[model samples]
Target: MGSPCLKTVGAPSLEELRNSPAFPKSEDFMKGPIAVIECIEEIPCNPCETSCRKGAIVIGDPITNLPRIDFEKCIGCGICVAACPGLAIYIKDYTYSDEEARISFPYEYLPLPQKGDVVQLIGRTGEMVCSGTVIGMQNSRQNDRTTIVTVAYPKNFFDEVISMKRIKNKS
Candidate 1:
């Protein structure tokens, strides 16, 4: 698979990500689940910060500053996953198993996929990266209408699979 470091890839390039203080260390990505805040822009948003119970996310003055995550304090509860209006925050578990990993992201589309349903995993640039199985889903009034869906995918696509294709509901 090609790298996501391309600036035109629609996702933040690896080089750009490395320059950000909010970027999580590569070593930190493997220690169980953690919020992968992909808020590349400097927009004024901080719902993820208020949603984090551990204070792992911080958005200092200007309020427009990108949120930084302290991986050490992040419990990866995914509360921030649904809190982000931009739908950029995600929960990833690289240590799920020997060959499989899982990702949880905010899914707003209707007719949510059921557990065990296989779906195409999409990459950072909206490309089909691979397939994954729905493992869990959370929908509640507290989360508003954002449904946090978790899916299991191959461990190899840890960096590629950022989301899944939203299937159109059958008539």
Candidate 2:
């Protein structure tokens, strides 16, 4: 029997992401909280659009279309972050503080970090960029098992951080 072929996936480059229509602009990021759809592929999925109760996420016509987020209508609830099977949705709140920002991402793993716990912020390419504090975590039944973890970091590193890793204690 032949083994299944595996394809290696690399993080999207900044230039590539900036060129995408789905990526929010600098002005959009500065305007309160908003949804950042990182989904780059054209897959037949619409859970993000359906999960949003505020009707902010729009995937019109074909289900394979990339999600279009109406920033003005988005409430930054982070519900869509957990609902996305691809883990492509994220919520960012630049208004958290003048020096800091909050990012909510879908997490599904053991030893989940709690509020106030210090964690290592990882970028899209799985590289550690900086340290952040866990500000909040939500794992309600409505989330269907995906836990959403919110981390706060310096506003300067907002564009670099996408996820977090729990810090381990040295023996």
Candidate 3:
């Protein structure tokens, strides 16, 4: 069989990080499994490349290909959430509990909700399923400017929710 596209290399070298590895099939890390994207578009993004405290994510020489996040070093601190422009980067902790998990993502809406606010959680396709609670909101110095909001949802909905919107009332 062909080699596993990307294997865990202990503390890759600068050259190794600068060079791109034959990335795993996007489908593998794309939707099902919990993941964090360093950046979605090619554009010009190094914040994720440099913002990583553990050197988990890498953007190679061309800086156009999608970043590769080393699942090993990720600490789930949600730092990269502030660095991503497409608001694609997220901290997905599928191990929040034996039965539940937390999905932290970027929130850029007006009248930003505070921690403990009950909100209707929507899926990537904008379908609202269950409710989630805001557990944390960080806009500290290290985050630059983007507000990182951590919400806790049912373990079953972990893969379903990508972006969330406030639920409006019926008139």
* Reference-based lDDT, each prediction: 0.87, 0.82, 0.64
Q: What's the TM-score of every candidate structure?
A: 0.91, 0.88, 0.72
- Candidate 2 clashes: the total is 0
Kindly list the per-residue Cα lDDT of model 3 for residues 20-135, writing each as its tens digit. Answer: 34222335333332345623335766677777788877877887766887765666677767776667667776667666667777877766778999778775445686788888
Top model number, TM-score: 1
Ranked candidates (TM-score, high to low): 1, 2, 3
lDDT of 1 by residue, 88-123 (tens): 888999999899999999988888899999999997
- Which 10-residue window in model 3 sums to the lowest lDDT? 4-13
Better of 2 and 3 by TM-score: 2
TM-score of candidate 1 against the unseen true structure? 0.91
What tens digits encode model 2's per-residue C-alpha lDDT throughout 1-171?
322211234567655666766788888988877888887777899988888999988887888897787777888788888888888878888889989999999888877888999899998778899998899999999998888998889998989888886545545
Q: Per-candidate RMSD vs. true structure? A: 2.6, 5.0, 9.7
Model 3 TM-score? 0.72
Candidate 3, residue 75: lDDT = 67
Give the C-alpha miss distance for residue 121 in model 3, angstroms: 1.4
Q: What C-alpha lDDT, on a 0 to 100 scale, does residue 27 get in candidate 1?
A: 96
lDDT leader: 1
Off by over 4 Å in 2: 1-9, 166-171
